[model samples]
Target: MTSWILGLTGGIGSGKSAAAAHFSTLGVHTVDADHAARWVVEPGRPALAEIARHFGDEVLQADGQLDRAALRARIFQDPAQRHWLEGLLHPLINQELLANLAGAESPYAILVSPLLIESGQHTMTTRVLVIDAPETVQVQRALQRDQVSEAQIQAILQAQASRDERLRHADDVLTNDRDLNWLQTEVERLHRFYLSLRGGRP
Candidate 1:
């Protein structure tokens, strides 16, 4: 049977990962775009070749892999460089995401991507689910989890679509302002709704 592909997205530190985890517990197959992007550029992937061409060999470390720290520093220093990197990786990631969704044999598949709304990939899914949190909470969580300063968190958030923008684009919104138990309950409710979308009894 064709699986129902649900696009899961959220702001930075909005607990989208936790929501995806909850879906996994219900036997839903989940494909994370960030993880897929990393995998495609792993050893022996053409994405590495493209990376070398765009950013030069310096982006690769002695072990012949992308130096994430170096690349992050470079991109943050220049908006054009960051856009170039996204242009190269986004298409490849989308291709792989679609492939994984097509190959899924489960009742549904969750495409967990932070940029689902920004990248315009939400159109490929049956529904867009946003794991939302207030900007203050998001900034706080990001600062604590990533060990970055408030200024850094602000810059990151500024680059992303606002919480209001995300809500405007969402078919469903799972607020992550509360605790894990709340997150789990919201995910369960969504899981059941996803099943109903596929004409299955929840």
Candidate 2:
């Protein structure tokens, strides 16, 4: 089957996860990049070995698992380190993502990646969907959701592509400023549209 893989992404705290969940409820299987990324670096995985080799033993926790908190602090504090880490992980993540896609049994799949655009993974997707909300809402949601300070949230946002950049690459834009009912309605519409695109009934 010609899988209608859609790249689903948004700025931090833009409700992309909520939007992706709604779409999944409508029969679209969602393959989360973050989850796949984590799987690649699991204990004893080849990716984990490579990571340890490159970044040293400090990136691991006392139990020998990936120290995500320590790694995040390191990356956020240094641009070169962040890029180096992405270079190490992105390819492995994409490989596992493609393997997952190959085994998918759904009408379509939603590839939810926070860095879909910046990481250049959108090129593998049939279309791009962006969840959008005002920056104020993003900041508020980030602070509440991640329990981080405004300064830290701003730094994270600064490292990512701007709202305009996301919109510019979007084939579909789901606004998340409203209630779940509105989001469900949009998902229903998209479900039918996606089926129609593949010559199937809703």
Please state the error at residue 93 of candidate 1 in Å. Answer: 0.7
lDDT of 1 at 148: 73
Compose the digit string of candidate 2's lDDT tens values, residues 85-110. Answer: 89988999999888887776677888
lDDT of 1 by residue, 1-202 (tens): 4556788999888999999998988988889998988998996899898888888888899999889877877887788988988888889989998888888777878899888888878887877889999888998888888997887777777767778888888888888999999899988887777877753323
Lowest summed lDDT over 10 consecutive residues: which window, candidate 2?
193-202
Off by over 4 Å in 2: 199-202
- Tell me how many residue pairs clash in candidate 1: 0
Instruction: Evaluate all candidate structures by whole-model CA lDDT and list the values in order.
Output: 0.84, 0.86
RMSD of each: 2.2, 2.3
